[model samples]
Target: MKKTLFFASLMMAAQLNFAQEWKPVGSHILTPWGEKVTAQKPHPEYPRPQLVRTNNWQNLNGLWKYAITPVNTKEIPQQWDGSILVPYAIESALSGVGKEVGKDKALWYTNTVTLDKSVNKNNVLLHFGAVDWQCDVYVNNQLVGRHEGGFDPFTMDVTSYLKKGAKQEIALRVWDPTDDGPQPRGKQVNRPNGIWYTPVTGIWQTVWLESVPKTYIVKTKQTPKLDEGVLAFQATVAGSQAGDEIKVRALNGTQVIKEQVGQPNADFELSVPNLEAWSPSNPKLYDLEIQLLRKGKVIDQARSYFAMRKISMEKDENGIQRMLLNNKFTFQYGPLDQGWWPDGLHTAPTDEALKFDVIKTKEMGFNMIRKHIKVEPARWYRYCDSIGMLVWQDMPSGDLGGNHWDMQPGKISGGNRDKARSQESEGYYRKEWKTIMDVLHNYPSIVIWVPFNEAWGQFKTKEITEWTMANDPSRLVNSASGGNFMETGHILDIHNYPDAAMPDPKIFGANQVLALGEFGGLGLPIDGHSWQQKDNWGYQSFKNKTELLERYKQLIRDLTRLIPMGLSAAVYTQTTDVEVETNGLMTYDRKVVKMPEAELNTAHQALYQAPTK
Candidate 1:
């Protein structure tokens, strides 16, 4: 009877925790998913989908103590503000503290974790999926480490700071200057206007802790060589001994497909008997298992996955440059996805919410998406790879003040002005861009590396483009999109508002793939679903849903015509309405899908059926 009463008490406590709600603190608007959010369990999914471990991890995404303090404050504040929902930026409404931490103030967060035997015995790793600008992390009042990037995940080995059978305290201090600082912030400004949106501050992604063995496989770099029918694997081991061997196995569900064993931190290859290339038509992925063994005993293991895909450029039957998937001519078309939620700024409200956007794009008969000047969590790309959606990722632009915005670069345009950034700012840009590439290099969906957009913070064009191409020769490089037209990249992209238009084939067709990087921003603002109370904008505005659907279909028809004109791909304005921009197929709140899915899908199918010009 005592044991039964104890179990009942525990159940009651769990129910109470689950019932703790967190209402959005903003007046702008709220998404459907926002209402479902709770302070006790926010973004409970495993943060990293690409690199997965079955167990020995804990989610630390519950309510956290947050305080906005002076920028130069070194010590922890004596007073603490109310609880804030983590994984949501402090500036975001979903954070439960819709407070701004400007250049002069730093956002502080503190939390405690009750360590069990499992976490205390093994080497502990604390991971922050992403934190804006700069941050200093502390464990038990000792400075653990510091990170500078806003979009890349950072991990710190906290095994040394662990106290067995005791509560481990974690604290973070974050500072972001927004547009005032020369970082790749991607349309984030203190003031919200036509193009720029609200700023994101502090932690905007998942925070978790994992326990690993003393000697474990830290990372594995997988490169599927489609032409050779072999998968290249490079493993990096931490705390590896002299006799440790790394075992890599590619599995088809439960069946072992291929296996290879090599020394720790070495390279090896596994050949597939019958290679199935990954494409939009058939998205085949092989499950990967990596194990670290010492003295022929399994000491560490990690689960991962990969796809056999090849992306390149080739000339079609008409001698026109085309973007090829698996060495075949397949036109890529999708939206210029900004990846913003009404509740969470840089972060998605939930894992389901993140996957919903990609699923909708695919269901709408799109094969690709141009991820606009913002980076998403790794799981977003994993969904694209799983569901067969191509990605053109843009490097977030910074230092926009010094550059000139060239609306259009006509044929034969050569020399153009470049942004003159400080040496410190330029170094930061190079470091962060390389880091972003390193973190997202494994995903198969990413086909193109776009270094600049609309000439924003464009500097040393030829040099940067060449470097980007050389760094990853496997993927194509789009140096600039709709900016100072340079004759250096694989794809020459142009942005034409409201209608579909490609780069002039006579000049760029011979060398680069002609693509309409952005167009067809047909907008319709639903009366109650709009972000703004009065002012809202789109490239082309409409009154009713019927009118919006008609204009969108017309734009699709115009896009089909461009396919025969050597146009490789086209990106519509957006996936959802963001801030005051009502140009999306869905509204800002994700409550209303502007056009019917079937109608949009039917119109989009015509473009894919067209022959290459």
Candidate 2:
């Protein structure tokens, strides 16, 4: 009887272990980091680095129950379908439920948040890094909040909804229309082909819970003035009384450089005696600490950082406008980064994987990256700030139906330039663009803001450009990247394929900075590293690695000649091959790097020389 009971116990243990195991659902290629992910914990780092509270927080990024119901369903379903990963989208292989949730269907998720007395504080904030399209969140079957953007983070105060028990349930219903709606979804489409890729639904980023005091700092904006040698700091305090105070300190390592005390929601400037300008060669950053006090007693505190750098434009000896960093002319050159992963469609599998691309870009000797049509997580920008890589941020393009593109210089006309969008579409664009700018304002790496790309969803050119300028007078605005050059913004940009070219110095170089937005799409697809076995594509395809390398070298040589003709900056085709687009320096899965980094670094050093008359 004892032997039989022991064998039964072993069998029960084995069954439970098998049930708990998790694996990726699809057969698509995955990055090395994706293979390391487990169901126990996915993104185990702090979600918000800018406003960090180290001790009292929980990372809720494991598995959760998911269901796909019709859009007409009003209430949360009683039974869920199966278990899916919390951060990965339903259409991705990492989610363990690789299925499409279209316009007619709504994706739902349910999870429980346990209230541990040691971790739960006076106030609880539920935060989401991002949710695709539209999402409505509920806590304990009560609606908490609804958010409607694919790229911006949102938070909700769920402290009031806690019950007497130790567990609280969370339900999320997400709806994404992809190309059918007039939202700002960059390159997602229902029928992905060519340049377009797969549709992402539901959560695609980290979700966590944060604990704070009754009166805490909601947000803070720290802007550095390089010319005046001062740092401007402002805090948005929540639940503040008349006598509340905000104390800020700027530190170099453990030593305090400057300290100041001010009222909440008011700006304060602190002076730095010896300020070092942040550049690619020396990316120096100063640590920061902010505390909230009531009558000289500390209530809350958080940690942050900032850098001292500046971006401006000035004319050279030849009367051509040149891009300037810290009042010095420096040539900016890099690839168009798409920010996609084969395993995790919209999100990187790990934080290390996200930083790997930027590290590789720095190793390859590029000094800038034009983040094309997609906004990455906050950590990505932090990596660039510390590693000294300049970023050109692009607003995701949508409502792409009413475009009349004119790419040439002299052929641009007022009639076909800006598309007239509907009132609904226009409202969505304005709100989301402003929110994106507000969220990314503190990062020092972002140097330029791009509004439109090649007339895709371009509308009200002069009005939008003026608004963007007035909103943030600190950085330069590209207005429109490649086409519909209304000559309103600071840059005159153009796109050329397979060859190097620039805007005419005689026509617009005196008034605006000339930039080659895109060029050099040299392609060579590896056999085992491609998305598909056949039908791979690029702007210019090659036979092998040797031919591709020679072609790339010739293209770089051609690009170097144009620098003397007032080309201030240039962007290559891409950083990595996304989907069927094979014109990338690296493979889709990030496994194979076709070109040698040392040779590329050596070749790129020629483009930075001072232009000769």
Query: For model 1, what is the alpha-carbon lDDT of residue 451?
Result: 94
Q: Give a tens-digit lDDT track for model 2, residues 222-276.
A: 8889999998889999989999999999998899999999999999988876989
Residues 369-428 of candidate 1: C-alpha lDDT, one tens digit per residue? 999999998889999999999999999988887776665633534456677888988887
Write down the TM-score of every candidate. Answer: 0.96, 0.96
Instruction: Look at candidate 2 and tell me the lDDT of residue 100.
Output: 97
For all candidates in order, the CA lDDT equals 0.85, 0.89
User: Which residue runs of candidate 1 sit more than 4 Å off their true CA positions?
Assistant: 1-22, 409-413
Model 2 TM-score, 2 decimals: 0.96
